[model samples]
Target: MNLLVTGGAGFIGSHFVRAVLADRLPGLEGASVTVLDKMAYAGNFANLGPVAESKRLDFVPADASDAPVVGAALRGHDAVVHFAAAGVTGIEVLLEAAHRLDIARFVHVSTGDVYGSIDSGAWTERSPLTPTTPAAAARAGADLMALAYHCTHGLPVVVTRGSDNYGPYQHPGRTIPRLVTALLDGRAAPLSGDGGRVRDWLHVDDHCHGIALALLEGRPGEIYHVAGTVELTERDLTGLILAELDLTWDHVTATPGHKTGDHRRALDDDKIRRELGWRPRIEFSSGLATTIAWYRANPTWWRALQSE
Candidate 1:
């Protein structure tokens, strides 16, 4: 199959690209894949290094917002994996990709943050979207637009929102890599507000596998929540990493965080599990160990991108 993937250089995008090319998808051996990315500060080409010269992979440095560029690239492709757009850049780019791409399926990659924070219960598929960030707000608009295309233009579109994912090739500025960087450097890893905020963490490999499933198996106009099995607070999560390092909580130190994001964030994956028979394969503890090992083995890959 020939697939067009946007944001192919970013963490999750690159993971999906590698999976398809490495023939992890059954009956998809030797699949031809194209990666379209803007290579912004967050979308680094280094993430794509492993697949850069693969016989089945191609990289197109283009913005998804440019209609003609994306449209021309979409021609004759089996599907459009739209993982592009600013994770925090907001909805404008989301609308642009939908308008341009015409393919069998437009798998819109999204985050669970669009549901905002819930104090009492988990958000099901029918939960009202009350996003608190500009990025989530824009994504809501983008999700609605993709659904509209399914209804009006008869485009096969599926939207999947998942929790924060961590694994190899993740940009160092993100939470997991930041913590790993500090641990490796013997520096006081930064934590905000005593690490009270909680997040549903998924391994990137699993999350991208869910995306691949959504592209191949999902029905049009449906929404899927690709979540992992664990939800832990920043404090406990940091403590877990410290334990792996044979250190204590005192080894880490407190730092302030952006006041706007959620104090607790998690998503409900029951719908995806029931409908698609998909759930995270990597357990939280194993995922943590694997992530730590990945950082340790590939220090040069991550350390070069460390923040000042």
Candidate 2:
């Protein structure tokens, strides 16, 4: 079987590529994997470094918005784990792929940001989508488009919406990485407001694991939410990082945040657990500790991205 993974060079997508090439799929037929990425600011070649020599891995430098390239690449592939998008942009191009591409399964990686800020409670698959950001709105558009294809033409597309993802190989612009990198350098992380904003944070491993489970067990046209059990305020989380390194809250500070989504992000994930028997193994506290240790070891790794 052949797998075509869009955004394969990205944080989560690269992990998926690594899993497939590592032969993680047992009892599966032959495997040939192709990764199509636009090499955008978020896509990094370093993420795919480990699988560079794998015979099953094929890297195609392109954007998912380009239909012809994606169409040609879709030929002869058995499945597609669609992670490519203007991510926060939530573009509507994939609706075209549902009918145009020949694949057995279409797995889309969506985000909880699509649900907007929960304000006071958690959201479920039954929850309504009230997106406030252009990026998230684009994701909603594409997700609905994929499902429409399923309803209209029997296209087998399944979408997974997840919480904030963190850990190794993340672009510096994100939350946890930026926080850790900043604290390690004795610098203040430009945070949003009082940093009291709450979010459901998941390890990158868990996010990819959830994606993997969806690939194997998800039903057609289904939407699953992958979430960690913990919901933390940015202040509390940043404090944890500082405390781990034996620093005080005064050691780091905050700034205004992008008013794109909700001040908080919380989602209901019981469906993925009941349906796929999936849950996060790494606790947020421990994951943050390990993430801090990794940065302490690689000093210059993310420093280069500070100017960005």
Candidate 3:
């Protein structure tokens, strides 16, 4: 298969590309990949360094919002696994181009944040979207557009909504990496309010694996949830990171006025597991340790990004 992946230089997209090239993802062995990335602040070419030399890999540094570039990139690819979230414009452009090319499958990567905060219980594929943040609202709009194409034009779209992902190469702006990087620099990590925001933590590798399954086998116009292996509050997660680094609460400082929206987020991933046999293989404990070790050993990578 020849796969064109948008935002392929970013954290989750790069992992999918590396896995495809290395034959790590099942059903994608020996598949060639064309990566279309804008190379934005979050997009790092270094994330693809391991698979750079593969003859089957190709890289295009261009914005997904540019129609001419995106249309040209869509040629001769069997499917598109879009991870770019520049805006709804980019998604519409990709959808139009794929529809023109009659692409086999269009995997629109989305986030569980579209469901907003849930007081209790988990959100299913049938849940109504009630996005609060600008980013999530845009993503929710894009998801609807993708499904509309399937319904109106038969574009064979499959949407995968995943929970929060944490792994190496994630931009330091995110919560896990932010905390890990600060602790590594011997600086205090900031906690918002009481630090009790709830989140489901999915390893990036497992998240990508679920994406692959959805791309290969998911039904048209259907939505699948790729949930995390563990659920915890921000305070508890901070404690784990501190324990891993042999540090204490002294390294953590609470900011009184800061507020991060969404008190809790949880997803029911039984659909993907039952339909596609997808399950998260990495445990939170080991994944956290390895992620911290990665940051410690690769200060040059994260530090350079942080300095920019």
Candidate 4:
């Protein structure tokens, strides 16, 4: 099968590409992949270094918003897995291009943050979008646009709302990598508002696996939740990082956070598990350990990104 994966050089996208090339994901073995990436701040060529020699892999350094470019590259692909963080306009163009190409499956990878902050109970696929942050609002808009394509145009599309992902190749600005890199440099990691904001953490490997399931088995116009088995607050997560690094609270610097914004989030993944038989396989502690070790062992990979 020929596959087009946008933002395939970014953290989660790169992981998905590597998984497909390694035959780790079901239904995509021996597939040829075409990657369209903008090579932005988070997009790095080194992320695909492991699969650099794969004959099935093709790289296109371009923006997803470029309809002419995307349409030309998307031809003859069996499916499109969009992992790019293109705003509403870019998604519209890409979805149109994919629809015109008659792609078999268009999987739009999204985030749990689109549900905003849920004080209690996990957010199901039917949960109302109450985005609080600017980023969340933008994602919510994109999700709506993607689903609309399926409803209004009959373009086959499936959406997966994944929880916070932590693993190698993640940009250093994210919570886990930022803290890990900071602690590695013997610097106090910055914490916001007593570090009590809650997030469901899913390992990048598990996230990609869930997306693969959704891509292969999910129904059109449906949304799936790919969530972690465990949930942790910012304070709890920071504490775990400190423990992992053998540091104390003194190594953390608390900063003020939003007072009126949503502070907690969790997802109900039962639907995906029941319908597609998908479940997160990585344990949080073990996954955290492995991720920390990855950053520790590869300083050069992340050191240059720290300034950006």
Best by TM-score: 3
Better of 3 and 4 by lDDT: 3
Put down candidate 3 lDDT per residue, 1-308, tens digits, no spaces.
Answer: 99999999999999999999999999999999999998987899999999999999999999988999989988999999999986678888999999999999999999999999999999999999999888899999999999999999999999999999999999988889999999999899887688889999999999999999999999999999999999999999999999999998999998773354689999999999999999899999999999999999999989999998
Per-prediction TM-score: 0.93, 0.92, 0.98, 0.97
lDDT of 3: 0.94
lDDT of 4 at 120: 91
Q: Kindly list the per-residue Cα lDDT of model 4 for residues 124-222, writing each as its tens digit.
A: 999899888787787888899999999998988999999989999999998899889999988889888877888889999999999999888999999
TM-score of 2: 0.92
What digit string (tens of lDDT, one per residue) describes model 1 on residues 147-210?
7777887778899998989988888788888887788888888887878888889999889878
Model 2 lDDT per residue over 1-308, tens place:
78888888988888777877777644342578899898887787878888899888888898887767777877888788888875422224544554666567888899987888877878998888888988788888777877877888888888999998888778778888888787777787656788878888888888878887887779998999998668888888887777888877677766876676588888889899999988788987788888888778876657765665
In candidate 2, stretches whose alpha carbon ends up further than 4 angstroms from where it belongs are 24-30, 87-98
Name the runs in model 1 displaced over 4 angstroms: 86-102
* Candidate 1: residue 227 lDDT (0-100): 84
Report how far residue 267 has shifted in candidate 4, in Å: 0.8
User: lDDT (CA) for every model shown?
Assistant: 0.80, 0.79, 0.94, 0.92
